[model samples]
Structure formats: structure tokens, C-alpha cells
Target: MCRWLAYSGTPIRLDELLYQPRFSLIDQSMHSRYGVETTNGDGVGVGWYPADSPAEPALFRGVGPAWNDANLREIARSTTSPLFLAHIRASTGTAVQQTNCHPFRHESWLWVHNGSIREFAKLRRDLLLAVDPALFPTIEGSTDSEVMFHLALTFGLRDRPVAAVERMAGLIEAVARTHGVPAPLQMTIGTTDGDRVWGFRYSSEGHSRSLYYSTETAALQRLYPDNPQLHRLSEETRLVVSEPLGELPGAWQPVPESSYGVIQKGADELGHFEPAAP
Candidate 1:
């Protein structure tokens, strides 16, 4: 299990969200409230799309505990972006290396995941083989999370994200069935193409990991007019996280089980999610 957060709208310093909240991602790295593990210190990574238009997102990753890393702190304090993703990993079996950390990138897209494929070791070979040959060469790590990212790309993530992910999940389950495994997927994922961000919560079994999205920014500002942070963000600002960052009573909404959410420049959407055959 792991923890992550994706933010869109309003260019703000990373530290404002990564460290300023009561239960910020930095705090979650050492004391998570909903993740399977409280300490996700195996590694940490951040990817952000600059405020400038049509630019490739920049990335920074470290194979170290985020709470203890001076470089991470400095970067968070100095950089700002309109869209960004931050992740702290808790390896399910992969080596603890920088490349294995999340917020994986390809072209302009950035992705992160907070759960694992059940018994990934059994399905690894088949899953790897199923990836598009062109993408296979770009996979730099051995985590099921990274492989899932590539599989999504192979299935047309750039052109049709939601369906590609559905197909990826379907294929994983199909392969798992052939190997006598059950409940093959468990994930709370965040992905963006430097424009809109998509978040999902799903598993082969009924139960999935925790995922949540913030209430509309303008509404929150009205409720807590005295809260300066709320005022700093624009009406389009939104966040999708592995858990609530603060205990603001009406500020966070749990993503419905087996569903997907999209956060964009204007209106957002939450739609039923189902895995279809690839």
C-alpha cells in the first residue's frame, strides 16, 4: 500500500499541499491513517506540469524516506505548478529504487497508484508479455504499478484513458484466471495528461482501497471564509488523494466504491467504473 495526491488548478508551491495540511502527504509518509501501512518510506516521487502551456511535466524521485530528505523539502519549498502529483511508496515486493517510485511519466502523462495486483508474481510474466513492444522498452522498473501504467498506454490511454484502464484491468483478471488466481487487482489510481486528471478506485473483489476527492473550491471558501488557503485557490481547483488531508467536515468526499472521477478546468465528473474485456 502507498499514499498519493493529485492537484489541479492554481499554481501553488508544492510544499503548500505536501507539508501545510494537518495530514499532508509528508505526514502520511510517516503516519498514514487509511493506507494498509502507516509508513510508506520505501521511496517518494513528484511530477508536475508547469503553469506554462503544452510543456512536458518535470519529475523528481528519491529512494528515501520523504520526511527525512532535505532535497525533497527544498524542492517542495521552491517549485510551483498548476497540476502536480506526489507519491510515497510502500513496496509490495519490488526493489526500493528511485525508478520504482510512483508518479511515473510518459510523454506528457503522469500516473500514480496506491494498491497492488494480488499475487502479481504469478501473473508478472503474462502481464509483461501483453504490453505493447514499443512500451516494453520504456519500462524501467519491476513494480506491478509501473507495468500497469504501460499496459494502460498500450490500450490507448492518450486517446481514451478510461477505457484503456478498464481493458488493462480486464486483461490482468483474465490472465489471473488462467493461473488459478482470484481477485487479481486492487488499486486507487491517479493519472493526468497535463490537462484533466482521472482518479479511480477498484478491485477484482468488491472491496477496494480508500480514495477521496475534495469538495468544490469556491464552495469550501464560502464555508470557511476565514481560511486563507481556501481563498488562494481558484474555483476550478481540485484534489484527489489516497486519504483526506485535513479533517474539514465537508471538504472531502469519499470516491464511491468501483467508480472513477475526473477533475478538469471547469465541471468535474464521477462515473461508474467497470472492467470490460480487452
Candidate 2:
């Protein structure tokens, strides 16, 4: 339903990942090779950790198309961070507005998702009521993606990300079953607390959206050998995206279906996951 990328490791300018690649996020906004829609012009958002407070992530989002957002270009040139999350949106039954755009923030964490809930209107009320009342005020958007964020928070995402996500999927399934909606929910979620970034790819029917992670920095350096741009990155750098950002063959590997991946400095791990029971 959308395209997104999460990056963690050595500090790098936003442009390095958003604009420089042949199939960059911005390029994907205009022409996606592996998404339901090629043009994700509904909105865009970026979240990053400042040099001073790595624990506090800042976000910039808008309802305008990314290709036409001048502010995005300016920020991409001027800002640099060790961890970042960006998304280009294609609306899935919600109003296209700033607050509805993603990379939703709460304290030290930021999150975004790339799919939709089946029959959202039928279950919105129940799902909303299930959220922690304390978190209700922070819920500014009306998208199922943001609702999914708060559900994870209710299940304790800040302290136990993996389990929190599992709980969230369970809640979604429960709501879907309550309404007897047969269509499956598809979710490819990315989240970061400024230190460790996590991405999950799953669906209720067992067929989820696309996701890919970059080859290990050491391996890429050896493969590229003479490419100065890639060589500039520290061995700890890594990126996970909804699709390959460029034509660099072998530079990206598809994340396995029904799995979640964690990315930290020099640490990249993938684990098989099961949908939370309804």
C-alpha cells in the first residue's frame, strides 16, 4: 500500500539514502517497481534522531507529494543522523492530511507502516476503544497505521517491541473476526527508538507486503571495491526498505515473509514470527 525505509548506523545525510540511489525513496514515490501503486503521492514523512538526543526522534511530515515538497529537499541536504525512518504514502481509506501521515512519534520512539486493515470502518470503534486511555490524546491521526501504533504501545512496545507487535496483530485479528471480514490485513511495519530499529513483514492470510535489507556493509565494500560512495560508510551501517532503492544488483535481499528484522550498529538479525492469535 506504500513504500518505506528504515536506516541505522553511522550518521549519513538524508540525501544519501533518499535521493542518491537509482530507485530512491523519492524515485519510488514517482515510480515504484514492486508496490500496489507506482505513485505514492498522498503524503510523505521522515523521522530522525538528532546528534544530541539519540533517544528523542524528530519528525517532519506533510500531505503533499514528496516530489514536490521543497521543505523535504532542504531537510535532506541539511540534516544528518545515525538512525532515520522515511515513508511515501498512498492512502488506504483515510483522509490525506498531515496528522494522518506516518513516522508517528511518542517519546523516544517513531513508527510507520506500509499496508492497510481490511474492513477498517467495521472495526475502527472497537480497536480505538482498546487503546490505552493514557495514549488516546497522542492519537492525532485517523489511519489504521497509527491505530496499530497505539495498540502496540498499549501492549508495551517501548519495553518489548517484538511481543508488542505480536499482540497488535492479535488484536487486529480479533477485531476482524468480530466483524467477520474475510479480507486479510497486510502490514509491513518499521519502528525505532533511535538505537535499535525493527521492521516486520506479515499479513493475516500469510501473504504480506515487500521488504528488503541491504547487504552487510563489509560484503558490499568488497563487492563494490572501487565505489567511493559505498566505501565512505562505516562497516556498521545498514538499511531496510520496502524495495531496492537502486539497481545495485545483490545490494538488496528480500526479507522473508512472516518475519521481523532488527538493525543496530553492526548488528542485523532476522527471526521467524507467527501471527498473534485472535
Candidate 3:
């Protein structure tokens, strides 16, 4: 399992979430409170839509613990973006390398995950075969997360992200059943395409990992009228995280079990989620 956070709203320094909070993503890399593993130090990565060129997202990843990465810290303090995702990896059953780090990117989209595809070594071949041949070549790492991303792309992520992911899950579970893995998946995923952010919580079994989104900006402002940061953000400012960054009352809402939600410009959407036939 891993720890990740997706942020979309007003442009702000990456460290504001990656490091400033009491229980920040960087802090989670060393002392996570909710993840299955307390320390997610295998690797780290972040992808953000640059302020000058929001259409092009930039990635800064390293095969080192984020807690001690001077370069990552330096860049985080200097860069500001309207949307971004940062992840600290705790490899489930794969090699610890730069390519295997999360916040995986494809064109303008970025993705991160906090769970695993059980028995991935057994199902990897079948899952890989289902990816579009054109997109298969883009698969740079042997992570179930990376493979999952490309599978979503093959299923039409660019045009219908929610549906594509449902189809992707359907196929994985179908394949897992054939191989005798009763509970084949557990995941809390976050994804975005520069414009909108989507977060999902689901598993083959009913219980899934934790996923949360910040309360609406306007509401938070009313609750903490003295918090200057809250005052600076737009009503749409949002954050989707593997866990809450702090203990602020009513600041984070758990995404419903087996559900998905989107944080975009207009009113955000929350809906039941289930695997659809591939």
C-alpha cells in the first residue's frame, strides 16, 4: 500500500500539502497513520500542471524516501500549480525503482493508487494482454498501478474516465476469478486531467482502503474564519487524499464505500461505483 493526495484549485506551492500540514504526504512516507504499512519509503513522485503551461503536467520522481529528498523538497518549495498529485510508494510486490513510483502520467492526465491487485504476478500477463497494443509500449514499469492506468486508457479514460475505470476493474476481477483469487483487488485511486479530479474507493471485497476529500472551501472558511489559507482559496478548491492531513473537524469527508466522486469546476458529483462488464 502507499499514500497519495490529489489537489486541484487555486495555484499554490506544492509543499503547502506535501510538507506543511501536520500529517503531510511527506510525513506519511515515514509515519503514516492509516495505511496498512506505516512507512511508505520505497520511493516518491509528484506530478503537477505547471502554472505557465497548465496543459502540460510535470513529474518529479525519485527512487528514494521522500522524507529525505532534498531535491524534492527544494522543488516543492519553488513550484506552484493549480492541480497536482503526490505519492509516496510502498511497493506491494514489485521492484523499488524510479519507474515504479506513483503519480503515473499520460499526456495531460496523472494518477496514483493506495492498494494492490492481489496475486498480480499471476494475473499480470492476462491484464497486460488486454491493454491496447498502441498503449502497451508506454508501459514503462511492472507495477500493477501502471498497468491499471494503461488499461483505463485503453478503455477510454480520455473521454469517459469513470466508465473506463469501471470497465478496467471488471476485467481484472473477471481474470482473477479465473485464476482462483477470491478477493482480487483493493484500491483507493485518484486521477485527473489538468481540469478535473476523480477519486474512487472500491475492492473485490466490500472493505476498501480509506479515501477522503476536503470539505467545500466556502464552508471551511465559515468554520475557521481566521485561517488565512482558507480565505485565499476559491470555493472550488479541493483535495482528495488517502487520509486526512490533519485533525481539522469537519474538514475531510470519507468517500462512500464502493463509490467514486469528481471535484471539478461546477458542483462536485458523488455516485455509487461498481464494476461494469468490460
**TM values, all candidates:** 0.98, 0.97, 0.99
RMSD of each: 0.9, 1.1, 0.7
Best by lDDT: 3
- Where's the lowest-lDDT run of ten residues in candidate 3? 269-278
Candidates, ranked, TM-score: 3, 1, 2
Tens digit per residue, CA lDDT, model 3, 32-138: 99989999999999999987898899999999999999999999999999999999999998999999998899999999998999999999999999999999988
Give the per-residue lDDT digits (tens) of candidate 2, residues 1-278: 79999998778999888898888999999999999999999999999999888877889998999999999999999999989999999998899999999889999989999999998988899999999999989999899999999999999998999989998898888878878887558999999888899999998888888999989988999998999988888888888999998878779999999899998755578998676774
Q: Order of all candidates by lDDT, from best down to worst? A: 3, 1, 2
Q: What C-alpha lDDT do the candidate models reach, one value each?
A: 0.93, 0.90, 0.93
**What C-alpha lDDT, on a 0 to 100 scale, does residue 156 get in candidate 2?**
92
Alpha carbon lDDT of residue 269, candidate 2? 82
- Candidate 1 regions exceeding 4 Å error are none
Better of 1 and 3 by TM-score: 3
What does candidate 1's lDDT look like per residue over 68-158, in tens digits? 9899899999998999999999999989998899889999999999899888988999999999999999999999999999999999999
